[model samples]
Target: MALASPTVAQAQSGTAAQCQTSGANSVPELHKEWILVGWDKPVAGQSWDFREKLGKYYDWEANDVVLYDDMSPDFQIARSPEEYRALWESSFQALRRAHHLVLNGPEVIAGDKLSTSTLEFAARLEPPESQPIISVRARSTLVWRCTSDGWRIVREHNSTRRITPEESRQLFGF
Candidate 1:
């Protein structure tokens, strides 16, 4: 499924209205939608196409954007949009199937220009061809800034811990 791209003016106004009315309360739903888009099954013989959504969801043009993931090397920072894209693309390429479920609060703190939220989620990742599926529970904090384009993520920190197969079954009912 293709996501529709709103005109710049529409995005700006829509973002402002969203901030004024729902504030960061709407971020969790948006996050879920993004995850749904990310997890869309790829066509045979093709890789997942995330370039458009990546541009829409992230503030790639911002110099201050940063991402830290526990899965990455210790102290390794993805400081540029290209670095972030590389990381995600490489990770997605290794996965035959990926399932991510929001398991807890996106407790939010909203401000005029920025918003922060924390989310807890469970992930079940299946590797290529008969490999064992990996399951984990993770927590992430995201900082979003209202920019000319829309509400874009500027900072993120994520940590994860592996879950036992039984625990994964309990959480996801696979």
Candidate 2:
């Protein structure tokens, strides 16, 4: 009997993504997932993929993740796993439906078991036919920690500036 070869995802040279580590632990999978879900177009099974990974990555007991989203008027604090999951799901539902999303210029710093990253990204939303296009260029900061399971976000904050009509024309080719 011939043995089956391990798939690339399993036999790859390194982890899914890379982050600055002072010669220590790396949370590549978590990093990659973050980028993909942030910018890439929605893909089949992505919602479930995020659900499973997030459940494993977040520290439910500590529940330290605080999300300050530009779209929300109040800060969202998750004190438990369920709360975190719900918040994430709600956010993902909206993001996953975006017409276009792009992540750019991400910089990350890693320490003994903690890391911080910041990036600028853009998202465009176009409603049904004969509607206007809305876009935003936002800056986001994320703080992550390495737990026994893996790396998990402890804090996140995002702010955005709306793109003017001219800028929108250039951006969306309207």
Candidate 3:
């Protein structure tokens, strides 16, 4: 499948509505739902119950699943769903509050049994005990496969950079 390039206008308009309408396919919609269930809602609710909510989106028994998250340590290459769960649970422990805002595409390329998408986002995170808030900008690419159970992520890579306080203020209105 060919990847569709976003127009300058579409690139600048990073609203949820824009994301939903940018692609004329079900993959984009499924991507949005995946993000909402896996990240957005749990983060918004400040809940650490990720394994349960995110279980359906992953093939826990698959041997080839992988994740690379830059924010994690050198040992953060999770090759199994259990390892990913541990990583997420560890991250959640340090966060008192976290909010993620989608900044760009789920620009997607889809096929009969496989699809991939890229997403850019900004996050505001607060640490426990009233520590100062931290803001980060990040991007991620996810590969999903159509398994008998449904669409499940088989690979993911994410990278993040800390945003300056001033930049955070500009982006998040703090």
Query: Candidate 1, which ten residues in sequence have the lowest lDDT sum?
Result: 37-46
Give the Cα-based TM-score of candidate 3 against the true structure: 0.76
Best-first order by TM-score = 1, 3, 2
Candidate 3: tens digits of C-alpha lDDT, residues 92-154: 656776667778887988755677888888877777766787789989888877665556778
By lDDT, the better pick of 2 and 3 is: 3
Best-fitting candidate, scored by TM-score: 1
Instruction: Flag clash pairs in model 1.
Output: none
lDDT of 3: 0.71
> Residues 42-88, candidate 2, lDDT per residue (tens digit)?
44234433456455545565646565666543656655556656655
RMSD of 2: 10.3
* Top candidate (lDDT): 1
Identify the superior model by lDDT, candidate 1 or candidate 2: 1
Candidate 3 or 2, higher TM-score: 3
Error of 3 at 65 (Å): 0.7
TM-score of 1: 0.79
